[model samples]
Target: MNLQKFSLEQLASFVQGKAVGQTEMQLDGLASLTQADAHKLAFVNADKYLDQANQSKAGALIVTEELRAHITSQQNFIVVENPYLAFAILTHVFEKKHTAQGIEATAQIHASAIISDTAYIGHYAVIGEHCVVGDETVIQSHCHIDDGVEIGKQCFIDSHVVLTGHCKLGNRVRIHANTVIGGEGFGFAPYKGKWHRIAQLGSVLIGNDVRIGSNCSIDRGALDDTIIEDGVILDNLVQIAHNVKVGANTAMAAKCGVAGSTTIGKNCIFAGAVGVVGHINIADNVTVTGMSMVTKSISEAGSYSSGTPMLESLHWKRAAVRFKQLADAPLTQMLKRLDHMQAQIESLESTFKLRK
Candidate 1:
């Protein structure tokens, strides 16, 4: 927790933001507004948290341009285009550097594997035959990298992760603990009333700058490689099925599952617990809200949501009953009969007006 201190002006310059109020104010660490003291920095990105910002005892704050006018506090602050993004960048600057360096003697590395001198292989990590691990890549303890797996420079494969089936990783990719990449997919064939297991013959191709969270399971393709393009982010416990091609810069939140052969477009954002059906094409820049089930393809880029809104149990049951009955009701014929009665009433009203 002994982070290097940075003055308000220096941090603002580093993040390419504008510093306002006390430029000489020093901040040693970051904290939330409610938890911050006088020496800590905090940020307010939305209006809902503005009240807490005003009451915070922190020495400095990061704020967006839209939120700048709302601050009445005397605390030193920096106004940026996006305060949250600036905060995220600063978190990297304040992160502690890994102390582990070089390969441990207990690691099992095959003679055919090509590992760089700068890479750190932890104790008990197994590197299989013909594997290529690039410079400065960290293969943490208990990680099992299978035969012919290629990992590019500066990638971090955390502990207990299994990279099998000749998967490929591009530069600076980060895979968290307990994740399994290029595992056998859910493929099967039916013959004579029994299921036959289909061999997953493909691999997984992960692009640069992708960060996958802990406990994720990414299945290998049945024939073609499953592709996860550059800058794609996957949260914890996400399930990516076989042959699914996740486009560049797309982000998926926790517990989201994509079925096999789905082609998700670039820059799309899927919120928590979103499920996408197989073989569907999602257009670029689409945003799926939390807990929505996408059963079909999306051709247009926009925010989409499904699932009924929460209601009381009694009211929900009543609505559900009526909804089920709608299929059997002749709604079109009922509307036509109502229209005819309305026309007759209008004619009678016209005659009464004429007699009057």
Candidate 2:
């Protein structure tokens, strides 16, 4: 018998679902429709996957009400308004729980730092001066919490992560490994043919429930604080530069780079490798397609894309020439040419009418 097995009623309550037919059936874990066994639970979020659900040998399924009728065979499933969301919620139930309490020996803690008794500081993790670590927060192995930093309750800072320059994080924040918050921004001024470095004076302020992925960099601001609002999720290898204010609940995919001083609005989705230029504003509810470049401000909420699609080598070479042609013709020149063509068409129409 699987140690992690869950009864149908027990799993239904976790997602506020209605269990049907097999209330006594036990599911050991969650799996995809194509791979689930009789002891595993599966989900069908749409009608297209109904065939997969029908053939699956799973003990039960999680599905929406509308798709239930599409199954050819009798199925014991949990009915929910959103099967995908229920799947996401149930994933935590099967996740491996790591429980740790009390600071480990060989960890360095400054006397001025205030750490809650319930917090866990793992082996060799460094807690710097005047830092406040809240209750039930876990600072894993070799992590560094520098001077004047504050992390709120239930926050998890993973191994080898760095929180420096007095940065402050709100409750329930999760910072993955190899991530560096409050690093210096790329700020330099040209003086006598040499670049003079400008010190980053402000730290980063991350709000509650923010999840930062591994190997990501969130830079400190040049003068004002870099603000990441509540519920923003950044994928791995993403870069947030100086003085940027990322609005609430925005999701940035991997390799997306936002330049300095730009303000991103709430609920915007940046697909993978999308590059946003500095000093521009992106409106709320905007979705930029993958590999697109955002150079101007987005005022209206809509989907936007840039760059040409992939082509064969020779065809791309010809397309590149056409792009160069448009680039050589400035916007003002194009507008003037359009006006001239319109006048010529009107003149030709007038001449034809007189001749007729």
Candidate 3:
């Protein structure tokens, strides 16, 4: 792919940075300091990267004002308050080249469904009956969109993503590869030595600006709707059970398991590998640290953690022995002290009465 060139002056204004060197220099694309060619632009965000930035071959460099002295190559520079953020913005500009464009002939689109002409449907993608796909939405190869599913504008459904029947997605929602939406929840009843599955009647309703990572499974509710509110981000390998409600703007990291019927509040964050038990309510803005095992309801909006660290074998053995003896030691000491005090009081009282 041919690199798109942007003037240094235009880039500085786009990222809200200050230009120090030649503003007319053209930058082809974004690159790391070590990998940037003469036509590319690189950035240095920290002091540790100063050495690499100084020797970089890029046409222009984006860096903080404090690191201006490290630029020894007389190259163009875009000084900003936050170089890391500026670099991120520029990287996004370059990554747009990978976006899909036109629909493929092999795609199987339902005649009853409404798909915008601007949308791209990749090879072997299936859009079911009564489904609606908005403008500029891209359904990648091998994707399965079930009947009654509604996908909003500008959404990107990656390869192998399965959107089950009646799933609704809002605008700008991005689902990574192999993620399953609207799967049946683990609801079963044991009767007469055999297990009977409860019908999952509800569908998944996802809000706008949501990003679901790869291999995540979000189960539909058993009765009511399973809702993921706006701006929620879910990491890879996470399992959101049936009837669980995730509030708006909440971000959950990888491998987090939220059990059935749990109501997670708005803006809550769960670190990687956190386990939340079923039927609990978590208040808004709650933050759970990594590897925490949440067994009860959390009403407060703060960080919580639970897990014991490993200890040396000898020290742990000694601590265990003391812990076991703690209850008996206090009782034995209290009885002996009580007897001595009673004897002293009796002797004093008897002597005083006889003297009187």
Candidate 4:
């Protein structure tokens, strides 16, 4: 736990919220409404959690203006436009900065590399030739920064990270542990029924404020650069293939994969397990639901979902049979057949009337 203490007024000011109650009290930390102690601050973003907020033992609570009046609590409250956002802003105040000091003796830095005076290089970290590490950049232990890599100011390269082959990271980028950036793109050419390797010539360019989660793989380009624009956040185990251009502020959930040469527009949200094929383009502000597969270009911006909803065992078995029948003859073909059957029945009725 952080030993630092923040006054109620100070916390409210930091989040640009209004302190509606007592301001003399101090808070040591933050927690959820249900788990907060008397010295901790908490937040309630919705009406469903109001019960927890009323019962909370927190020193102070951040609440929205709409929910503030509904709460029947005597606890101190900080009213903000968005309580969740305010909570996010205050989280940084209590976060512990990395304690690793100056460049360690065990670090192996190339003579051609340029490291900032304010940078921290941890034990066994490797800095390759011609690499540039900017001010306040922290390359943690076992990190391998390969040749020609450039990392901008205040970038955090976590433990076991591999940044290689002309990769460039902009300022304030945070790559978590075990993430591999600028790896070789999977480019292959087939000739005479065998596979041949294609030399990857381009690099990866990551913009400022990008956060890549752990175990993520971002491949270098085969010819054109793979670009991840500013403010993009990638969840763990995401795969970004070569020559792909991800626009600014795009957020992808865990296990999302964008295949090579795809261009995704700005502010797109891809939920968990979303898979996008190569050579496609997605428009801005697109929201892909979880477990969705994007096989073609998304020309319009909107929400998309695929696959069947969860069902019980017996119901799923019956639906599965119908799904197979529909696959054999889709909706259009089935409708055409229905029209033909109706026409035949009307002709038979007319013939019977003529015979009478």
Stretches of candidate 4 off by over 4 Å are: 329-356
- The segments of candidate 1 whose C-alpha lies over 4 angstroms from its true place after superposition are 64-70, 329-356
Error of 2 at 210 (Å): 0.6
Off by over 4 Å in 2: 327-338, 344-356
C-alpha RMSD of candidate 3: 5.8
Clashing pairs in 4: none
* Alpha carbon deviation, residue 96, candidate 2 (Å): 1.4
Estimated TM-score per prediction? Answer: 0.89, 0.93, 0.83, 0.93
TM-score of predicted model 1?
A: 0.89
Q: Please list all clashing residue pairs in model 3, or write none if there are none.
A: none
Overlapping backbone residue pairs in candidate 4 total: 0
The models' CA-based lDDT, in order, is: 0.93, 0.93, 0.91, 0.93
Flag the better candidate by TM-score, 1 or 4.
4
Local error of candidate 3 at 160, Å?
A: 0.8
Weakest 10 consecutive residues, lDDT, candidate 2? Answer: 323-332
User: Candidate 4, residues 1-356: lDDT per residue as tens digits?
Assistant: 43999889999999888887779788888998888988999998999988888888887889988888877874588999999999999889998887655799999999999999999999999999999999999999999999999999999999999998699999999999999999999999999999999999999999999999999999999999999999999999999999999999999999999999999999999999999999999999999999999999999999999878899999999999987887675776988999999999999999999999
Give the TM-score (vs. native) of candidate 4.
0.93
